[model samples]
Target: MPPVGRRERNKQEKLDRITAAAQELFAERGVDEVTTQEIADKADIGAGTLFLYAKSKGELLLLVQNSGYAEALVEGRSAAERIPDVLDAVLAIVRPVVECNRKQVDNGRTYLREIVFGDPAEPHHRDALALTVQTEEAIADVLRRDERFSADDAAALAHIVSAIMFLSMAATINRTNPINDVVQEIRDQVRALLRG
Candidate 1:
């Protein structure tokens, strides 16, 4: 019933355009093979304009990551309050992400492969580390809420959750075992880690 605000609409439209362009280029040539110019061309924008949305290819990659499945991961963490189990908070992000991987299966595995070998540290190496810490803090918030997991244990559990997710995602990409089977194993390992 209400008309969309111009400024809000413009911002989202810009982002959508950029991401669409990037996705096309990324999917065609793979993450590392694609260039900003290519993405801009695909988006029909000047190369400099890409900078307005993201700093470098890596930031663009993270931004794209953030815009897509990354939201599912972040949303669960964002829901966590200080009163809940931090492990559960961590699990929230992990669970949805794993679910996404199971659904995408192919694209998910490709993205995981690209992220691992890709140039995440292209401009600011710190960005990668920051992403790491961001997820860690999200997990911490979940664990800290419970008051049961010690600080050290909480942090450790968070790392375990992170590691398992990566491994499981990677294993899914490997296709040696089904995603569901790997997921159950990861869940079991995570449960054991948290209990200890």
Candidate 2:
């Protein structure tokens, strides 16, 4: 890798501050309650400068949540690797994700909606697409390690599992159903998919 230049480093630092400030504010108050100006102020950047990083408050929330989701995926993958059963392993991978999103369920509802139906040109949509692909690859990797699932089948099955997970999570956005129940339901769905 080439050495980092001053301009690149400064840009990254600004992004880091923006991300940290957004996360803190969003957590303290819900996504809908936080404003772009608040985030910019917290980050010590001009409000106009914040727009250069994210087009809107929703995009800012998406950007902040993406990092948390990525970390959850890493933790989930590590936890899943230790499980002996493929079904349990997959649940391990998914549970952390649901937990992470549950913290900001309202924003999550909007985030998922934007991801599925938003403009292709939006940066958050692009980030979400990449995240989805990476998640499926992780699932496929786990399945490939198991004897029951073939490499060819693993990729397709990963897509199915992720779709089910996304739908299940979407359904829980406003409902009273316990998060564990949602996770268990997903586990059962995965088991049925594998058995078929």
Largest lDDT belongs to which candidate?
A: 2
Return the top candidate by TM-score: 2
Model 1 lDDT per residue over 111-189, tens place: 5664566665554334444555677667766776666877887787777777787778777344656656766777677
In model 1, which runs have C-alpha deviations exceeding 4 angstroms?
1-16, 24-38, 46-60, 78-90, 100-107, 113-129, 145-148, 172-182
Global lDDT of each candidate? 0.67, 0.85
Q: What is the Cα-based TM-score of model 1?
A: 0.63
Q: For model 1, state the Cα shift of residue 106 in Å.
A: 4.9
Residue 169 in model 1: lDDT: 77
lDDT of 1 at 173: 49
Which window of ten consecutive residues has the lowest lDDT sum in model 2? Answer: 170-179
- How does model 2 score by TM-score? 0.88
